[model samples]
Target chain A: MTDSITISIDGVEIPAETHHTILEAADKAGIYIPRLCAYPGLKPNGSCRVCTVLVNGRPQTACTTPVMKGMVIQNETPELKRLRSNLIEMLFVEGNHYCMFCEKSGNCELQGMAYRLGIKTPHFPYLEPKREIDATHPDVLIDHNRCIFCGRCIQASKTFDGKNVFQYIGRTRNKKVGVNADDGLGETDFAATDRAAQVCPVGAILKKRVGFKIPIGKRIYDRSPIGSEIEVQPKDAGSAQ
Target chain B: MANVATNGKRIVISPVTRVEGHGKVTILLDDDNKVTQARLHIVEFRGFERFVQGRPFWEIPVLVQRLCGICPVSHHLAAAKAMDRIVGGEKLTPTAEKIRRLMHYGQTLQSHALHFFHLVSPDLLFGFDADPEIRNVIGVARKFPELAVQGVMMRKYGQELIKATAGKKIHGTGAIPGGVNKNLSIEERDGFLKDLPQIVQWARSALKLAKEYTSEHLKELADFGTFESNHLCLVGPSGELDLYHGNLRAIDAGGKTIFDQVDYQNYIDYIAEEVKSWSYMKFPFIKSLGPENGWYRVGPLARINACTFIDTPEAEAARQEFKALTGGKPNAMTMAYHWARMIELLHAAEKIQTLLHDPDLQGTDLVVKGERRYETVGLVEAPRGTLFHHYEVNEHDQVTRCNLIVSTTNNNTPMNRAVEKVARDYLSGTTITEGLLNRVEVAIRAYDPCLSCATHAMGQMPLAVELRDRRGELLDRRAKGVDAR
Candidate 1:
């Protein structure tokens, strides 16, 4: 007999592994709770709360929270949906999400989530924060204006490439992505093939000498909306339909 | 950024139509109801200069190219040329130079096709007063299906050339600091050559159509936004028409060469940029003449006017007839820009065939690697006009300081002057008509300014055409989007 526990997500009773988190169980059950900073290989940072759900009558980051037996987890409630969408909107206003000007427009996970949430415009005013570009690397460019602080590059670099080419420096308000080198990206061995370079969900870190290689309308997310594949629909999911 | 001397009534055309990026047209009227100053304001602030500070020198070409989607290749090449100087290889390998030249011609063909057929063709074809609804590409297809299809096909071939040379059509990242990333594949080269006949025919037909249309409307075509002013452009070593790259030249309104063969890196020695408080766009003027007298024009008309000859056969033939339009002297008429654009398109096509026949373009050695250097200046003639990308990097090869003199910024003063002239001719009183607004936009559009590439700041009011009174009260505001017409 398989060791499993019955967990009630929204109204459906589903079987899950003993130690699986709500997000992992939900994924196994073909559900997408809209996540960032929680890639499959990396340790969950739970910084971007796009996957916040109601667990035992309280809000928790689904990536970190374990699935409890008979916990009555609410994955797709109206209140949870609003909370997740508001978080996405906040992320947009906080950074420079110039979708029309951005190279990562259609393929962007953040943009995809916005489309999935039916967000044509953010509720909050654009921050338009001044950011710098690090073009010191020979084969890549880091546009800080579009960084969303997902820590994917940090995790991916350390986990996948066995390097710490990127790291989050400073605290709230004065924080930014810092390169490993003291002078700049030029002093680092950051190749275009690095996993850290490829992990950017936005246009923040882009491979040099390959922009617009894909025409405008023929990109990854251009043909269809984001998150349609491998996304098992929750019968009670809110507003996605 | 010119100051308006007028006092009372004001007409503001915010978010001007049929141009790349956000811009504003403001006409200040005096107490006598005559025009005082009309200024074109470039609102968006990309701040590529500030943001590119910490990046490595090699990344300049790719990053700076993002400044404009329509003319990324120009930025890409300019940055590469600057980097070339830093490497002490300002002159690249023969093969590399030929490939770069070919890529530039591709850019010219695509950009001119887009500008002529997509942006301003309707006004030239159906009159400036054509319905706003049909003043776009869709309308072009509806009115002249063959011309519209040709335009699309021209753009397609141009895009195919870009894709074959670099990687993609819109913002291909082919040109690097030293040279290109790769040589043209056999398939890509053969495919482009196969369509040579069709491309040449279209260029010829475009010249004919533009000539007929321009001659028929000679009255308005000559008088519309036409002015005698100093012109500036890049010319070949022997004064043949050079678009991709060349030393800068200046000519006075009377068609006499004022300055010739001045290298671009030394532009600051002869050229000076003046900052205005009212606008983010800086006015670039000749250092000797000062701001008021030094303001000059650049672009297709200015290039055709300033150049002594066109190297290509078909374009040269077209150029002769165009030069005859003004008794062999440089024609200052702004409407003639379309004709000059077509002529250049023919030249570019001819140049394309020459480049394709050259075996040098197929050489295996592309980028020439060398020790990194501190600073370099790159200059290229964008389809709109001249563009400069200057950068100073640290010992670690990180860019520390930067300066960019884009073509639109170079035209800011003349563009404002053109607006003022049009406002004086069109605006009668405080009441502004749709025709007046359209004409003002038409005058500004003659420069074909790309505000997105020129300026980068984002959050601004959506373009509005507002009529304000003496007391600073908004009198009338138009609708937004397609209904703005």
Candidate 2:
């Protein structure tokens, strides 16, 4: 068996594997790191920049940058908080994200992250772009105006279904996600049977025909995060990799 | 064409590049012009069908939505539709149905837009040899800034609409089996309506530009030679073109309906899927026939030809324009696929506007709540073509069997045939050129097949497949390359 390495996160010394990142080690030790584009199943994109943490006095995305031996990582530094707050603010203003009317209100990752970071008022001005609602299919809707282009859906489409259905169309601020060539989801060779939809971290791509099946109180994830519902024994609590 | 004999050996194109999903092409030719064997192999498998076997039936839509990012809504709807069938539920409320149509239109608009502008446009507008470095939409942004911006804006509008209407964008939780999960607020409806005219204008201008480009390069596109094959798509009850909800129809090369008005539930009876040892992708064909004899095509080109008329005025006009260019109803010419896509875009925009104006959209009850019955199936036309999701559940409402047939699978037979024909035409007579191969690949990409959704669950890294000869020779290999372009 390989020997474990020790690292201090927020003053707690935790045993970690040699290849573990500061975020991974800290997460293993019951530390929470806010993230959006860092799903366990998909490759870490680190585009959201919400999981930034102080590693050796510098801020970096915990999902991408790996850990070093004897590293002093600060997940809750003032600088880190300000950076995270700024990132969240940018995300809010970059798209037409009105959370109050959103069905994913209490359960949304973006809203939850914002609340955790204590974003009382959006520092940036609202950028309400002229957007269209594609509700052609009986099950899903796609709203590009509110998209952050985190590429989670794209990754999900490509990685899981082996379909390169969702692709990054443009670049930089002009960047957006769409079905290849702006085809309706119905026209793409995508099946309703693949599992890519469950992994989307935002509300950019949605079910079309069945938008409000259950009341707010009966939502599956309304009471707890997906992680919270699954029990974690001490032996099975480490990195899922 | 090259007369090289196979000697009973297989000629394989591993990791068939540029097409959607992971697959390969294998061919076995006898000494004569008669082809002995051809297989379009789906090389990667993640067992998505098997994985969903024991999960809760209500979670089928959510789980299956993760199957393909491009067409999650199709899967979501298909799963929901299937569940609705099982539960013996009434149809969704008028408002909910309208909202559903609007969302479906959004996905169609954005997805078709992406196919034309991003995936296939680069090859057409820039020329195949323009520059590998500048072959993507990003390069188009630099070369033709206005068009690129329009494309981005159009895509953003579709995706944004999806997020707003569905609550979450990619894997939205809005759609349940009986109906939708949320209603469009008056403000939201107004917001969507305000943007309709601009989108319509943008779509029209884009279509004009695309036509101009096509006319300029007519020689190259025409010289590509149109292939003849059967076309399959869905048609609405009013004899108008439809994608979301419709019965299946297969039309022959001569523009005659071969198989008309088939029910979605009887899909398995008409269509059959055959798996090849060389590839993981399965070739779906007309049942009771051999691979070579059962070829069929779907998606924009196929859908346009399969339908008699489009409902929306702008789309109908666009369709006329497409017919003018193709010298008949657009059938097998891949170039016309772009035009067909634009027509769908116009229709999508118009449909969205129409839905937004409906007064019932402001109603509170988006869902028709009920208990679920055991087995169900959902059917919808994805951008690429027909999509179906069937689920069987136990008494506890857990899925016992989940079978999915996606659009790519529908096109598998025709796509493999197209690749072989292109390969023989472009590679046989002369030395193989990268440009020619690229064009061949572009021809396949025009359909925008989604193998991933047909094969696995979301988030698994695509495993590259390579093929070697009997002597252990490397014929072709696809490395895990980055999407740098």
Candidate 3:
């Protein structure tokens, strides 16, 4: 009778509204789903299926599917786990990570996800692809080698700043996120002060001047593993807070 | 690319170690087994200027610090100074200036500590002829455990000072255009006071060791990487040594001032960069002297040779002794670079103690807001030598052009020259011992060069983890969504 509906994710029940996606509801309930290319508060575009879950014996993206009353969702199935691990592996093999010497290793989400998943070594072979570094911009650096094509910078640039400084070039495997200018970042209107520079999930888009200011062991994820901040609570568990 | 001309066999020493990043020594040998030419090639390519174009000029102060891990604060403040002009100001708040100076001194201290204790000491203590595998900090620790500990502790203290003053140990984001974002707290200043005596004593002891090393190897040191070259530095109006801010000064091999207090913006009018066919790094020289004559040295030895006095008592005393030893003339002996580095370590410690007590250091006024300019140049004496950052901005504060000449590149010609001399003197076709080969590396390592800053890269990736049950059934998942955290 109430506007709020109950949904069963795995075996636990979570309360959510009709407009809420399974991801949004589960996040409020403190149950997590791994994701890439799904920035919070941005429009839910299922770009990376790291957030896949089973609904009624079928796989669905947790970021896109809306919650329905009495719906049963299995978020952690062996098959889904395998798919995510394989996807992470595919990404590793498709690019040159150079994790041994990367500046973003400790703070990198991709590297952290591998650790969280207990990936001893990438199941796939290393590709060691050579990528260009777009250092044309005076305040930002774009190392295409580290890019996973998440589109966070492109999305933030367009949605928040009303600036089309970044866009995707090419199609499918040939695709890459690029700046507006043809020559380099210097020719584009990419502002160093823009939110786009800070939204990079990897070391692809980085603000300059801060070179290893904080040593490796003292970094954010180094202090606490990623996702340790999210705590699941019942919808009505305001008393605990 | 043409496999180094002449009928000579190419001898390549890839990645001369004990320094940061990647570099190679290529010596072209003629049929007579004599060195024809030696090139210290910087292979890494980092196009920093090209990537910073679209970014707003103000953001560059924090961004360009990524250029080098060894002396990032130099780049941070240099960029901030360049932006200080864009913000249309010549003076920063007293507290901000003091804080920046403190950070610079700390950068110098930690860098010197790393170079002296961690990198060069091993070779000096154990001798270059020791087993190659064991000739490192590990070897130093095994040989002289107490001294090794002192070096590590001194470096750690300097790093903490950097963190307290700059807001982080390395690429601190505390500074902005026109001024800094924060001031050193009284407690923070007091924290360093407790360690002053120990740091000063350690600096003096290091200097003593350096003197001993120099005395023991007088004949070898005299011949090792010793040559005549012009020296460049930044000196105060009174001709005193100044690292944070100063006028450019160039001293010839005879210790005569070639140029005094020249405008940094017009560096191109005097200093010119030459690119060889083999290297990505350009050789910079005084434009008036031309490439052949202009190739000069900049760094500790050059700074010590060009300056009048240290201003601090202890370092000033050491300076006098060093002056007497070099005969009041420029010490072009590349081996003296270590001694000069030790002297600087003393000066940096002394400067930090003096700045810690300045009343204005804790003042609240840190920044000034103003109208923007189109172009400006920022200059600072980095731990290695002088660093220059130039920028041009459009109406919207977005960058239009950028040019950065780091300290190491300034010494490219000298480094190459040193390598050639060592290769010619020590290396031969019939008896190419590892020790002889190491001397070539030792020549390059003398500069404590940081090549990673000269080259650059970009990176990306994603993360996800799914927990499962038996029979491939789902249970739960923990994910740091690419954007979630």
Q: Which candidate is the best by lDDT?
A: 1
Off by over 4 Å in 1: A1-241, B1-15, B133-135, B370-372, B457-485
True contacts preserved, each candidate?
0.11, 0.24, 0.00
lDDT of 1 at B458: 51
- The DockQ-based CAPRI class assigned to model 3 is incorrect
Give per-residue CA lDDT, model 2, range A2-44, as digits (tens).
4588877778777878776655666677666777777666777
Number of backbone collisions per candidate:
13, 106, 36
What TM-score do all the candidates reach, one by one?
0.72, 0.65, 0.74
Residues B370-390 of candidate 3 have per-residue lDDT tens digits of 776888889998888888888
Better of 1 and 2 by DockQ: 1
lDDT of 2 by residue, B1-485 (tens): 11121323222222334445655443334343323333455656778788676444666776777777876777777777787666565377887777777778888888877777777777877787666567777888888888777777788889877876666668776667677767788888878778889899988876776677767878777646357888877888754688778888887787766788888778778877877666555777776445666668888888778787888888888777777665665457666677677778888888888778888877776656466466666788788888877778776445789778788877777766666665555543222344544655666676787778766633333323222433444343332224211
**What TM-score would chain A of each candidate receive against the reference chain A?**
0.90, 0.86, 0.91
Query: In terms of DockQ, which candidate is strongest?
Result: 1
Model 3, residue B54: displacement in angstroms?
A: 4.2
Cα lDDT of model 1 by residue, B1-485, tens digit: 11122234333333567778767655666557666676677766779899778765666777778787888889888988998776666667788788889888988998898888888888888788777777777888998999898888988888888877766676665676667766776777899999988999998898888889889989876777777888899999988899987899999888888899998888888888999876788999998999989988888988999998999988888899998988988888877888899999999999999999988888977666576577778888889988878889775457789999888998898788877777778776576666777777777777888887876445443344444444445443332343232
Interface RMSD of 3: 8.1
Question: Lowest summed lDDT over 10 consecutive residues: which window, candidate 2 chain B?
Answer: B1-10
Could you report the DockQ of all the candidates, in the order they appear?
A: 0.11, 0.11, 0.05
